[model samples]
Target: MVEPSVPRLWRAVLPICLICFLYLCSFLLFFCATNSLIYSTVCLLRANESYCAEIDQNKSLIILEESIQKESSQWALYGTLSFAIIACFISPIYGSLSDTKNRKFPIILTICNAILTGLIITIASIYQGTQLCLILYIVANIVNGFGGGTLILISSCFGYATDSCTHKEQHVQMIAIIEASLNIGVIIGYALCTFVFELHTRIWHILLVHVLLLVLALVISLVFLKNRSLSQPSTNNLSQKIIQPIYDIHDLFVGLKQNHLLISFLILLFSLFFYDLFRMGSGSIVYLYLHYMSFDDAHYAAYFSFEQLATCLALILLVLLRRRWKVNDLYLAIMGLCLSLAAPILFAFAQRNKAMIFGAIPSSMFSIYFAVCLRAIIARLVPEKDKGKAFSFVALIQNLDVVMGTIACVEIYQASIDFFPGLVFIFAATTRIIALIFILIQGLCVSRTPELLSIMPTDEIEEPILENQSDDDNNNDDELIHA
Candidate 1:
């Protein structure tokens, strides 16, 4: 078969890129709106207008500002927990569906859910300072969570890219490009929030824009993207269809348990878990951290956008290194983990706005390396049929991070806000250290057992045909051949 041209391949993945870009823009806009509204509500409930106005203007009411921060953080934690708890359970189901069904439906469902969330948030912001507003916020998160939220969209996009590619090299490049698109979306989203807020626009206005963009994304997914799946047809029984993905997850666990490369899989999973725990924990509270450092919305957005740009550049560099230099994924992951470990420490010690902003540079350089590389590595480890379930499992771990990381970092930040607001970053740094240890151990294991590299069939190897063999025998032979 002739290989497709580069431009043709890019065209195929453009829809995935656009969808990711739009979803992230909506996600960040929702985040900024939520935080701003939470702060406004806390001030309204806790203090008089004159005092709140003074706090907003003066920026030196240390005690009162800390109080408001703690209160707002508590509310933010609740909102995050509500969404993450639901998404944690729903992610696997959607991931399984993408594997067993098609990728487009999940992508479209997520965008529709985002649009609904934007509308709910807009209404909530209008009713700010009321209990109903708080209730609506929680309800909106629950609704978004039920649709699988950002994690599901990301998982499905990765699964879609994986399905579209025929070779491991192409797979890695596609994953890198998708990861870059995610960062680009984040950068533009934050920048847009800053720009609109600088114009003194209301939170609802920004949310309206978010909803419109999501509607566009929904249209793209529905009309432009093709339904793609590698799994066989599902059973006609409704009950079986409902439970099959869950069963697939269980079977994946069983398969992992019995695999000869179980140690490598566990190490990679743990590394991903700890790294995400650090990332999510730090990210959930980083905005608040910047707030404490006297940074405004524009400042925070610029800082975050710069960091994301650096991350995007790093991903591009990774793709080049893999394609041109033929760098091993494990080595690149180790390098990224090593370089990223210092960022949280720098953030912990940062006292000035510049210090806090620049502290992320070390991390921005290589922090995304492990995440992108590990997913590609894990993809290479499993069979094609298990890719969806495997990525779903990854998404489950990330959602778990959303719950655990938010709780841990928010609690830490709340406790230390008065004395040392940087404590949360220190905790994040510790998690990265743990991730590094896991990756190092995996590298050692791989080096000691070279045959572990051959666990999966590469694209260069054509599937063998079994002459006059039973179906059962052929299936067994296929597994053995791949193994």
Candidate 2:
């Protein structure tokens, strides 16, 4: 059979690619504004006795660090959790909109939200000492939420790309590039913060600049992007076309209510939920922990950056493996189990000596490896039409990484300092074990359901020709972007 040509990343979407690059630059510059300027303020407050007299929590560094440790740091945990609610609303809805309308509205919404987010933060900084940081934080979180909540935007596009592909292996490669872009964004953001913004040194100004970068990115993206119609509208009735996405979201709950496949993925969800919570919440501790034990903060962040870089590099290895292994549900479950093990095991050993623990502990870099794998697995499980809803369901909880990490990881650190040091590992480990057990059980049950058995590949199952469309395609959405 003649094969359909799948567009390569660098070649297919030059305009969108430029938008992504400018967006990355803007995101990293904002990081420079917010974090890099403030590193020493952190080091000083934490290591007060080393230089100045007893440091005050209200001092520049102390307050910033505490802000991160607390649930209410404005952008860290509490506020993010609240704004994430807004994201939960926007992600899937925008995704459906993109599929129906070719992603223009949501992409436009993103540009507007990003601009508003910056303007709001800049305003808040003007009133920092007054009774206004709280309000600004909330608005900023919501704005950023709206701006960053476009994961489903890309997911929908990739789903379209996947649907267009003839070879299954091509789909996996495309998804890897998307996932890799996220890691690259993180690295650039941190590097910009460390070298440029100096956020740790200056409290308010840099943060405002970070806000401006969001606006800047929006402007850049708007200038560069060119939209293509994704899906054709159905003639049955405009009403059904308009409401198809809403029905898609409803089908998700219904799917969970009716099917066991969603439940199997949920087993993996718990691990993602808790692991993110602990890791993000306790991120600052890596430097602090190392410094307290007489290590260098610059070197520490560098080490972390390197670890993440390594993980990104690891994606290349998966490209080779994906083609060999069938990208199926059972394998996804197996990979999930493997990732769940990394965290608790790392946390369990983080209590050991500094050098050894740093080598073994499950840092953000290590977690990204798991994230990319899980994402690919999830993509393979569902059909293209439902991919937006399915991925949004994952995004609902996935983006809460910082909040959950703050709660599970940070709160644990604060309480455990003198009381129960190993509790972090215990909590992390136990959570994974429970999730793993659920997955094993779910996996066995999935073996029996003929609906699932027929859809997914099994030891005894034979590979079937790729269906023209999954059930969602039968819905034949008119208003979608094109997933």
Candidate 3:
């Protein structure tokens, strides 16, 4: 490989990295904003008391199961589902297009979408006294779907950079940085939720903050983030060329079907399913239980924060220890699965011990850190050209899991309203275990492909070997045919 002129590489590639940073910033912004609103909204339905009293009162009242279902029934649940599915598909479509198209095009599109989303939310907040507010919310959600294109944009550009890298070890480090952005985003988002909600009781306040951050992120993206090159050599123009109707999705699905790395990708996908299912499902139940057992939000928040802090530290430790950890990608996944599965049991027992942090940290670490490995694995498995499609397809799987898992959690909570509310979390955790078992079976089923972490350099990632064509070939054949 020709020694890459570091300057030219930086110029061509740094903008996408800038955009990726913007995407992370916006994601952290939105996620925190979403947490603030959702937490506030849910809290509104529960113990209508000061933060301190609310915790104590809620545990004994045990009416949250009823409250949530009543709240859902009051709204058209399908409306929420509509918001998610539409938001789900838009990111990849525009992102895949951006792979060949200029950076300006997608950035402009996302900006327009974010502005529209902001305006819609602003209007909804203004008229929130009327039923029309819900109508406005639906519109805002649709607009939000449009803005979701940022995730794909972020993923595709990283794929571009990953493909262009000359060294194999660089891939792991890059993947780690990419995912570190995500993990840190989550940590920051949760903190924002606590801070933002304290300032205003209104959901509108939270939504407005989300919009402003996104708008700012978009502006940064448009002005500074840029890459002028089109398809160069690797990753072929197959994905860049669109002949099929579902060209983007088709590319990902086609790869998963034929690739030897299917087991690895599939395990990560299922683990993500557990990640959302258990994490989202268990959230309130865990908190309320802590409140019941500990008797105050101040105390419980301390406990919750401690749990997250410990888990976040664990993520840092895992990234550090990853060098010495010799386990296959499968082993790391199983370790994560075991941790996630253990969280609920620990949570269930923590009530007796009154140490929420002690129980929750292991699970949180497993779910978050294991996911990082999964993405890193995929980055190693798939060729650089198709990273966008692979990552987005994985996103699709994870999000789809979220919808179903939420449904199951909601169903369990609804059925057990009169019973122990903690049961909802327990049920969700059980569902996750089932998914985990399947993942274990799949991991055990495939043992032939070399461990990705060993085969690929951690600093530079491995690109899939393109066997037939050499650097001498003039005509580009990006597709890899195994015979």
Candidate 4:
């Protein structure tokens, strides 16, 4: 293969591809930054009154004690968990709708919701009273959660990528790229957040920036995104709309059963649940732990940015390794889990801020490993038409983990704050170990039967549709394009 001819059409599409790629990267970067920094910012602000009061008990200031700070953090986290609970019911519906309708509509709507969230949250941060801020926070969460928030937005994007890809390898590549873009975005967002906070102590200025970014993302989505006409038309009446997601769940179950990969997928789902549990649970409280260790806002932002940088590097390294070695995804996932397992241990035992920072190195790799491998595996296991539903289900599992894990970790942290604030990290470490076990089981199952490793091989995946697909399925597919 000295040279391969390029298609003229590909050249024509190249500019469009670049724009889409840029849009994805920008959207993910902003989203990741927000995710990395938002909870910590809220917790820190809420704790500030306590922190200041503790420092100067008689300064005529409004400050609670360390216990109050911890309590405030817990309640803010609870607000987040509540939003996640609400989002759980919406994710599947939006997912199915994305599969049935133009993904752009949901994508745009989600970005708009994010914009609103950023604006409201900025205003909330400005409020001196915690009660008012909390109320605003709840309102923001309600708006954003009802719009399906980040989970549905990401799933829809993935579903779009799934529809566009022609082969298993391409799907894997797309997922990796998406994950890498997100990691890079995390790095950008983390640093930008820190810079903004440092430059403007008020903090709401950073929120304004986030709002601007969300608006840009929304505009890009509206202007450049195109809907795919891959699915068949559906003939279900308006009455069926309410139960569509439930039926989609059934279809997903049926799809899993037909593939004989139900056990494997379930294992993946459980692993994801625990992995997210560890990730999100630790994420919610670690800032408070760092605060307890005397780290300031800059230090906190730097720590998160470092981890994201590590994740970005890990993804880049994986891409390079794939070219030079026959690296297995299972081994990569294990490596990630091992890092995840160790980071939490280090964090839990850390006595100083520097020690806690060291843990970010491993935790960074942990961030990139599980999602990339899991999504790649899922992309291969489900039918093209059901990709939206399958990913939606994954999102649901993740949201459940986020809500439950956050609640559990916050409670643990609050209960043990006086005696052992690090207990939450220990709990996180335990969950990672459990997640690793589940992943190992999945790896072992695939290793024993490599032929069953991928549902369709790179060469044999054919086109988007299969010959055995039903007429109803075909109609559903077509209708989604028009819906």
Best by TM-score: 1
Candidates' TM-scores?
Answer: 0.90, 0.70, 0.72, 0.83
Q: What TM-score does prediction 4 earn?
A: 0.83
How would you encode candidate 1's per-residue C-alpha lDDT over 337-442 as one tens digit per residue?
8888778878888875577558678575798888888888888777777887888888889999989998998899999887788888889888988999998888
lDDT of 1 at 432: 86
Backbone clashes, candidate 4: 13
Stretches of candidate 3 above 4 Å error?
A: 1-65, 72-79, 102-112, 127-130, 149-161, 199-203, 228-245, 251-271, 279-308, 324-327, 348-354, 449-483
Error of 3 at 320 (Å): 2.2
Better of 2 and 4 by lDDT: 4
Clash pairs, candidate 1, are none
TM-score, predicted candidate 3 vs. hidden true structure: 0.72
lDDT of 4 by residue, 1-483 (tens): 212112322332332334334443444334433443444444455556455424323323323445544655666576677678888998888777777875556667777777777787778777634567667766777777777776677777777755655446555556666676666666676677677657645556666666776667776676667765446656788879768989998988887887778888898899889888856555647766776666665677778778877777787776654434535666777787786666776777776658655655866575576788778788788877778888889988988877888888888888887777778888987887888899888878886765455642433422221223244445667899999
The full ranking of all candidates by TM-score, starting with the best, is 1, 4, 3, 2
Question: Where is model 1 poorest over a 10-residue stretch in terms of lDDT?
Answer: 460-469
Q: Which parts of model 2 are misplaced by more than 4 Å? A: 1-4, 8-75, 122-135, 146-164, 167-169, 197-246, 252-300, 324-354, 361-366, 399-410, 420-422, 445-483
Residue 375 error, candidate 1, Å: 0.7
By lDDT, the candidates rank as 1, 4, 3, 2
- Residue lDDT tens for model 2, 1-483: 323232333334443433444455445444333332233333333355344222222344444444333322223444556556567666666666655555445656765665576566556555543335555656677767765444544554455445444434355556656556655655655565455323344435545555555565566546654453456754547677556767877876576557556665665566456545454445444434443333343445554455556667756555545445555544554564555465455545555355555565343233444555555556655655566666666666656655555556556655664444556666666655664565566567667766556444434322122322333333445436566
Better of 3 and 4 by lDDT: 4
Worst 10 residues of 2 by lDDT: 460-469
